[model samples]
Target: MGPGRYRFPVTPLAPGQAGPRPGGGPLAWIRAHPRACDTVLALAVFVAILVGAMAGPHGPHGPRFGERDLTVTTAVLAAVASGALAVRRRFPRSVLAVTGVCTVLELLLETEAPRAPVACSVVIALCTLAARTDRSTTWRVGALTVVVLTAAAMLFGARPWYAQENLGIFAWTGMAAAAGDAVRSRRAFVAAIRERAERAERTREEEARRRVAEERMRIARELHDVVAHHIALVNVQAGVASHVMDSRPDQAKQALAHVREASRSALDELRATVGLLRQSDDPRAPTEPTPGLAVLDHLIDGFVRAGLPVDLDVPRPADALPAAIDLTAYRIVQEALTNVHKHAGQGARATVRITRTADALTVTVLDDGTGPDGPDAPEPGGGHGLIGMRERVEALRGTVETGPRPTGGFRVHVRLPLHTTQATHQAGASGRSCRTGETG
Candidate 1:
């Protein structure tokens, strides 16, 4: 009834199914067939009542049977009281009412010497009702059964008001209600624990899926940066080699060499990025260190060689950036420059600037070329370069600004925190595997 406490319906087991009973035994079989158990219980109680009714401890020598005659009325009342118990679980309240009425009749009719053992069946039926129904209903029904039966035995029977038989009926009925309530409480507690465990398992599985998705995105961004950057340089160099193959033999050969170098670099990076998918114990896994500001010069040289002259300005800071921030900054600069080379028209130049503050490291890339608004702009969301950049920066809780400059050309400004959280450090470690390669 409380929040988040859901009660699911139980599904019945099919034939030959072990169900929840993996180790089947006597108790397991009894539990699996409730109606059969109830029937057996009812028959056993009937025999017990009849045996007790035919004997008494007031015998001359000791307790003995055959001293008192078993009358037809006594036999019929015992049979009726016990028979109703067989269907107690299906109709618990109705069974309890029938058993209680029979007990009252047996006590009232035997006025000369009352020895009604039908109260045994009433006790069993009351217990069944209490176990199946709620507390309020159990209290009301149990109290009524006890008061009625005890009053009948004391008022109409030959026994005194405070006789042991009258008191025993009240005690048995009260104990049955208490015992049944205990069983119901224990069952509810166990069910709640199982539901909690199942919910936790579902949460753990969802978290694993989320982590997998994040890893895939990280690998994708790394692959895009590596392939897009080097391939653009390769395409430019190959075109130059073809354009001046005859007129300028020396320039053509130099461009061919640059193309070879770019292609080799692209292959090495591709191999490293794909190697992340391999098992950790793989022998051919790449061990190359990830690129950052330390290799900015090498990255710029490749662009300058591909006919895009670039100006770089970076000041050394007091402390180094965190691995994640350093990697993100390097990738952003790489991606922004790659975009410039691919979309900017001929004779366009780019400027790269790095500014370090107390808490942040900012990298700005500006190109004096056709911006996104120009005819050369890629369609919105069509380019994965910017999307990858945004994802990387956001992962480290950084910011990225990309738009056209006020005067002309396109600009990409990114601010990365020098000191990142522990979660960012862990992400950097995971991503390091895919980013490891030779950038040259």
Candidate 2:
């Protein structure tokens, strides 16, 4: 309501009701007894001024009040100024107005001393407002108060316009505004820092969850490749052994042995997959080898026994393939063969070819039989087996093409870039080797 003195809605403690628990802190005490606290503060300001009036230097060894006891009017003015301060925090603008009027009256009327005590209390109130509010409000209100009060002191005071006491009033008010604004700035900075830290923590949690989901999808793909291929072969061989057990004993025994080997391969791959989940505290993983393109012959051996003849042609590079690409290629072949077993009927012949060019490694699997797919079937990412191959290839920025072959079967073609992937893998391995050597 007054210049810069914004009125805060002070909710007083309810009558006869116990407030917040005592000893909660200074803030709690003030809230619990707002009126009482304001009274104490006002009285303290009055006493401090009274002491200054008594002990402060007077005109050439004369009484500050000019040989007179405290006059009734002067005493009343002092009381008014002190009492107005009781609601200074709740109504700073109003308090400043009341105290400003009182100070001007003291300058115009009081004879012996014009350096008023009410002015000091006004400075304290202005400081509180600046700290709680914005800079524009504080500066506007503080400037208006300074110009009006300083001009009043010069025109109607006992002292001259250039008096040291007059200048002191200007300096103290400016200092109060500056100090309060500094406090406001500090609080805002701390709040911003806290907000940023909370947001970063939330982001980290989201990233961790995303990585976990990606890992789960990868593991499911691997299990599908290992279990599906081996289990299909084992099922077919078991059927063969049962069929021949009565007619040819030697043939049945051979088929039963093939079943045993297929089961064993499945278990080994499953264990290798499960080993990835072991914690650091667990014993080391089984030293069993992972499958790769180099093992294509042995892989074809199992399929040949299952009655699906496979032709494998893989030319080994002078330098081995990156572990990831090698493993992915092996899986692609395995999944392709499993699909042939499931979809292509008897008399199917599959040809798996791995060819390396200047920039890429290509893999193609073609099977001829009554393959269970139309020419319109989707490629790569849209289907199950093709989806796994697409995900693996695309991770390395490679490509996959799959569809029903016009000649009479299904065809899968994969091409993976070698230069970038192999280089990165070599750098990583080199770094690890250097670290190991240093540790030794």
Candidate 3:
């Protein structure tokens, strides 16, 4: 959201946007021209068989498979099957069928053919099929092909029915199918994990956006409360000064002085609120500490000087109050005093009482101003001061109560929990975590 998004240089480049890769590696080449891969594989098998046939003395081999010869049929069949492998991915089933038939032909004709069996090409094709197809298709085709090939070898070839050579063919084919299936399974698992990670990243971004929106709403409320309270005072004082400009020069001068005081306070608070919008590293940011209950006397003094005398009572806390609760308490008191000065008629008296306990803190403001029913809430649509106070209190898991006093004017009450949920948990595990408040 901030410059942090662009501060990192590593994520600037797009994937695959880097320079070209070096000429294709074996796997890349295979993927690019799979048919060529098949052809190469088939040729390798043919060469191995050819080398095996002439491994001993060429003219009359001393140690050979059966006969020392390079036959035409074996070469052609190996070539055909391996060449067919290139399109195995697109037609896995069809390629398996073709390669299987070729393998059967080679095994059946082994009696009259050369000593070499180029069966490796057929094995490769079957593996490709197994990797591409589902389990049922792979099992049915794989089992049938292995059985048919091994049976053909046992029935027509020189090897006996249970010969190790015949069994070796079964072993190789079975392993190929299993290995292909394993590769497919591993790929699917990795894909699933990648998809899950992407979903989690999206969820995290959505959560961040929600939090940012909530913070902006809170800042808007704070700005409204600060501006509304001081501006109301300034407006009232300015009206008084204007009304008495020619009639009572002394009273007009006093009203003008009050107007200046109210305007200066408003400007100072506005500057503080604006400074909060600055970057933390900015030198122009305000260095003044936030107002709290510690400044309650000075705050009430302003109202007293404004003609509405306030009886204040607050106790010193034995344990330090949490910063959020302290600031919220101060704001609630300030807003209440501001409303009393605005809506309360002349000769009105206000009383402020704060009770601090081991577990919680309570603030009450009662004003017998003999004015409207509810000053803070003059209409059906409530004023911003009460709403801001409620928001601040509720955000810290606190509650607020405001209504008309039974006998006379308005009453404002608020309760703030000293120990948060996390703090409560800590106190339960530790001993005597909270301290009692001192009476003042």
Rank list by lDDT: 1, 2, 3
**Best by the lDDT measure:** 1
List model 2 lDDT by residue over 343-436, tens digit each. Answer: 7766889999999987888999999978446763324333356566676776666777887799888888989788765645433222111111
Which window of 10 residues has the lowest lDDT sum in candidate 1? 431-440
Ranking by TM-score: 1, 2, 3
- Give stretches of model 2 more than 4 Å off: 1-43, 46-113, 135-145, 156-158, 357-360, 372-384, 418-440
Instruction: Put down candidate 3 lDDT per residue, 106-186, tens digits, no spaces.
Output: 766656642325556668777887776677877898898788877776676544466655676778888888987776666
TM-score of each prediction: 0.85, 0.72, 0.70
Q: Against the unseen true structure, what C-alpha lDDT does each candidate score?
A: 0.81, 0.72, 0.69
User: Backbone clashes per model, in order?
Assistant: 0, 1, 2
Task: Please give the distance, in angstroms, between residue 51's alpha carbon in candidate 2 and its true position after superposition.
Answer: 5.3
